[model samples]
Target: MMQRRTLAAGVAAFSALWLAAPLATAAVETPDALVKRLSADILETIKADPELRNGNIARISQVVDNTVMPHVNFRRMTSAAVGPQWRQATPAQRERLQQEFKLMLIRTYAGALKQVSDQRVVVKPLRAAPEDKDVLVRTEVHGKGEPVQLDFRLENTDGKGWKIYNLNVLGVWMVETYRTQFAQELNKGGIDGLINALASRTIAADAKTAKSAQP
Candidate 1:
């Protein structure tokens, strides 16, 4: 269980790097090219920014809200993570769930903003044809440790271009991993319970951040 959590954390840390990208690019680059460009741009930005490297939550949160959240398909991610209960959720409940899930990821991003270092991403050649709506961009993160396999699942929107909805790190799919963990909580206390549980986690993380900022 600890190993699983550790892997998940590592995934979150890397995911934060991509989430730091600018909301949109002027050119509609291929998915592989997009990932490669953002990986280098975001890492270099973090490396140069002292505040971001120091884990300044406000700064990190700003980057996430402006850059990360816009590119991510949060509603889809939240619905996938909640599994079957997602369809059952009322519109208000669905919105609440999305907010809570986004909050959790933003907090995770704050903790992980500093994790980007000399890591380099190498995107494998994309195999999809032009008409394909769904595609996978595969890559490996090579740096201070053994290379970690990272892959992204992006769906092309009608006009918005490719939007990231799922990511895999070291073979674990982010949504599936969360779904399994969320299922346990849902079975015990339902959607509200799950929301409350996520809220509690965000609250705890906030306290930890506040304490760390002290002298």
Candidate 2:
């Protein structure tokens, strides 16, 4: 409860992390180990950098690009959010959707990475078979109040290490939530409509970020 509000207000964005993994070569990073290390690194990076703590949009974008984007499985995340319409989308549209969605998240949460002073991530032991390719890792974010539950759904490729495609916070899965909204937009107009909606939100968020940055 308070953790969500605190994070949404301050912004660690485990929500964004669910969407934050991409192509990886052969690595032996286990899901829980990755979460523990990634979480620690992110917190340290934010607290150590003054500009990031101050919420400079440009700096935040740079950090996200260099640090987080590499680990995100963008296609799996975007396509799942787009639902069945994903297969119908052309390559260009798919690219646009992914771009806008990326911006929406960066603009929404990445910029606030600085306010993570008290939040500490505790990843629970992962439960899965040795042969499993897809698995969930449970975690908690401890802050001002009761610890909030966070979960990650990760998939592994033969050569690639674990990549996160979805995230859950406070009992809500981000993809499932976005899918419903995207479906509504799809019904109203189509893929274009959904893209437009995401674009509009991203644009508005950009404007808000700019204004905030203005001192």
Candidate 1 differs from the real structure by a C-alpha RMSD in angstroms, to one decimal, of 3.0
The worst-scoring run of ten residues by lDDT in candidate 2 lies at 16-25
Which tens-of-lDDT digit does each residue in 21-116 have in candidate 1?
764568777888877877877778878987887777677767777787666677888999999998888898888888888778777766565666
Off by over 4 Å in 1: 1-13, 23-27
What lDDT is obtained when candidate 2 is compared to the true structure?
A: 0.75
RMSD of each: 3.0, 3.0
Clashing residue pairs in candidate 1 (N, C-alpha, C atoms within 3 angstroms): none
Give residue 17's error in model 1 in angstroms: 3.3
lDDT tens digits, residues 52-146, model 2?
76766677677667767656687899999899999999999999999888878766665556546767888898898888889999988877766
Clashing pairs in 2: 20-71, 20-72, 21-71, 21-72, 21-73, 22-71, 22-72
The CA lDDT at 142 in model 2 is 77
